[model samples]
Target chain A: MATTIIETGGLTRSYGDICALKPLDLQVPEGEWLSVMGHSGSGKSTLMNLVGGLDRPSAGSLMVGGEDLLALSEDGLARFRREFVGIIFQQHHLVPYLTAVENVMLAQYFHSVPDEAEARSALERVGLGHRLKNRPGELSGGEQQRVCIARAIINSPKLLLGDEPTGNLDHKSTVMIMELLKELRAEERFTVVMVTHNQEVAAWGDRTIYLDDGVLVREERTNS
Target chain B: MLFRILKNSFLKRPKAVLLIFLSITMGAAVATAFLGISGEISHKMALELRSYGANILLEPSAVEGGFLREEDLPKIKTVFWKYNITGFTPYLFSIAEFSAGGKKERGVVSGTWFAKQLEVPGEDSSIQGIKGIAPWWEVQGRWPEDAAEAIIGAALAKRLNVVAGGDVTTIVRGRSQQFRIVGVVTTGGYEEEQLFAPLVTVQSLLQLPGKVSRVLVSALTVPMDDFGKKDPATMSKDEYEKWYCTAYVTSVAKNVEEVMAGSRAKPIWQIASAEGALLKKLNSVMLLLTVLALGASATAVSTSLMASMAERSPEIALMKAVGADRFQISAIFVGETLLISMAGGVVGYLLGDQLAEVISRTVFSSTIVSPLWLFPTAIISALSVAIAGSVVPLRRALLIEPVRVLKG
Candidate 1:
């Protein structure tokens, strides 16, 4: 009887002559973790971008948290992205000039007003208290990704989107990032839509949807 | 938060920020220097032209047996446009036989004030003479100082075979007077064909006391426009009043004529018209140069900012991807540019002041004091160039697609 937080009916996206995502009908209940699995060029990232409001669907309806994204302006979509969705890119795209704490505050700055103490606390939660003043160049790959996570979760979003959040990390660092996400999600009670190619990483989600050549192929449920 | 980001960005990317800053600074410096010196250049040029000759000529109304009163010369300093009358000198010419060094010749003998100081009621004492009005006259020796001393013209001295330290006897209708030749003057004009002596001595020798043939007046006047060229006799009451009040050469001449009885004052058009035309052209050239320099500097700033924007695309994309709206993105970039421009404005103003001084000293052999408003003008111009330069790059930055950029 859980309420559905995301509902997409025949959602589609195309770039010029090529369709990145076919008509996709999907729904995710509140607080559920949904994983999208696909091979290279299989439109997994396209779905994540559309759901995160970073890209628009060419056709069909997309409703997230009772808001019709198709009807919103570009600025409205930006507001929705800041208030409703937080995205963690696989590249760990942090502003190299800003420190770890300042990077987290950047998110709060866009959301409302920057709170330095809260940004510090968010970094501390991500286990980067000692590296608060260190810029992205001074941090390791895993540590930078942790700063990305801290920045993502600082605004308290309702839906968190991860595009292979651990694609560049080794097995140990990947496991640590997943464990941290699991703990944060348990406490925050936010929905997660993670896109990945690794079967082991997909196993961390409550359910997995596989895509092949821009079409949905199969589904799997995890008993975690 | 904006300030923090701007600080860190500038600290981290000194090369790009400095490039844009330098462009704005150069533009602002050129603008400030040109604008600062433009007004001074015209004034200096006018003063230089004034040395060519006097612009106003005063003479008796009648051509025959006509004379201007010598006592009326002091009233020239108390006219409505008195301050505009920089200097004036009176001349009394009489044909006489000049004899010096055992040689004799017939030439014109001219009496004029040679740097005599005049004090009028309710007016400060002022030096008014040929020395002030005709500065181009080159003298081989000193000017005459006493009733017995005279400065003979080069031609007249050559005709009489006389030099400085010689004595000359001038005979007018058999009334002869002796004068010590103190100086020999070369004027390249009719003055070189006449002998110059103190006015009082000439008046006494000619038995024509307190009488002058002509007066040359020099005045500072604005360039004549159509309104200034209008005849006061044909104008309405208000228009005539306006024309009379303006410091045009014609108006200033009229002011002098009204003061001197039975005298006609007219502008020496050869000098006044030439000065007006030259001043007008010089001002136009300065204005054109200022606009061209500003345009060139704007191009430099735009090119530099565009290049920096290209290099910073990834950072802008990252900001956009992190939920920075258009206003936020604009704020960051605009804030950075404004901070750089303000610093550039201050630096450019200082540099431009020095530049104006150098130009003034080199061209006019004088110094210039920039007006107080030039400071704010320079800063505003810098800001304008910065904003103008940021337009295209800011638009490009806003058009950046985060998905494409971050995917790289």
Candidate 2:
């Protein structure tokens, strides 16, 4: 009986002559972990970007948490992204000059006011307490990804999007990251939409959707 | 948060920040140096112009052998524009036969004040004479200080075969006077063919007491524009009044003429016009240089910022992806630039002050004190350049899309 937090009717995106995403109708319930699987250039990342308010749709309605994103201005979308959504990138795009704790505080700064203690606590929760002062260049790939996770969750977003969050990590680090995301989701009760190419990563989601050539081809549910 | 970001950004990109900072500093320094010295140059040039000779010439209105009243000479210091009259000296001329060192020569005897101090009623006593107006005069020995002493011009002295510490006797009509030659003056003019003696002594010999042939007045005046060049006779009452009130050379000459009765006053256009034209050109050149320097600095800053923006696009995209609105992004960039500009302003002010001093010493052979307002002027100019340079880069940064930038 969970209410739908994300509802898209005929949502579409295009770049000049190239159509990145076609008209599609879909709904995601509150607190559901949705995984998207596709080959390169299949528009899985485009859907994530649209849902996170990072990209605008070419046509159709996109409603997330009762707000029609198509009606909002550019700054309004930015506000929505800061208050309602958190995103984890594949490259772990932390400001290279700032330390791990400072990176987490950067999110807090853009959302509202930055609190150093809260940023430190977030980093400690991600098992990077001892490396709070280390810059991204000095940190390992797993530690840097952990800092990225700390920055993502610092603002307490209602929805989280990940575009191959662990694509550069080894198998052990990927397993650790997936487990950490699952535990955080259980406690925080936020919706997650993650895009991945590996089936093992897709298996961690509650439901998996497959995309081919910008079209939704199939869907599968995991009885978790 | 803004301060933290600015601090970190500057610390992280030293080379880029330094480049922009240097551009702003150079622009501000050039502006400050030019502005600081421009005002002083006009005044200095005016003083140098004054050394060429008096700008106002006062002569008798009568064409046939009339003389200006020597008694009225002190009234030249009591005119409406009294303070503007820097100095004035009266001259009385007579043909006399002079004999010195056993040689006799026919020459002109000129009577004038070398450094005569005058006391006008209800006014401060002032030294008014050739020493003040003709600062470029080169005398071999000394100015005549006694009624019986005289200074012979170089040409006249050569003809008379006289040197300093010699005696000259003047025979005028039937009267005779003896003068001790105290100095030999070389003016490279008609004055070099004359013998200069104390006014009272020459007056006594000529038997024309308290009569002067002419007066030369040196006064400070503003540059003459088209309006100032208009004739007072053609102007309306109000326009004439405004022209009279202004400190143009013509107006100052008219002020002196009003005080000296039966005398005609005219601006020596050779000096006055030349001074005005030179001052105007110098000011125009300074203005042009200031504009060019500021424009060049702004371009340098823009180029530097454009390069840095390209290098930092990914960071800006990441900030936008983390939910930084345009306002927040602008705040960070603007805050960083303003901080750099302020620092540049302070440093540039110091550098420009030195530059102004060096220029003043080199060009004018004098020193100058920079005005207090120049500090704030430098800072404001620096800020203006920074803001102007950052406009394009900031627009580019705002137009960035996180989806395309963060895509791997």
Q: Number of the top candidate by DockQ?
A: 2
DockQ of 2: 0.67
Off by over 4 Å in 1: A1-4, B60-66, B79-84, B93-110, B120-126, B138-198, B201-208, B225-247, B254-258, B262-264
Single out the weakest 10-residue window by summed lDDT for candidate 1 chain B.
B290-299
Candidate 1: which pairs clash? none
TM-score of model 1 relative to the true fold? Answer: 0.87
Residue pairs clashing, model 2: none
lDDT of 1: 0.90
Per-model C-alpha lDDT, please? 0.90, 0.91
Find the candidate with the highest TM-score and give its number: 1
Restricted to chain B, the TM-score per model reads 0.86, 0.83
TM-scores for candidates 1 onward, in order: 0.87, 0.84
Model 2: residues >4 Å from true position, as ranges? B59-68, B75-85, B93-111, B114-198, B201-207, B225-266
lDDT of residue B226 for candidate 2: 99
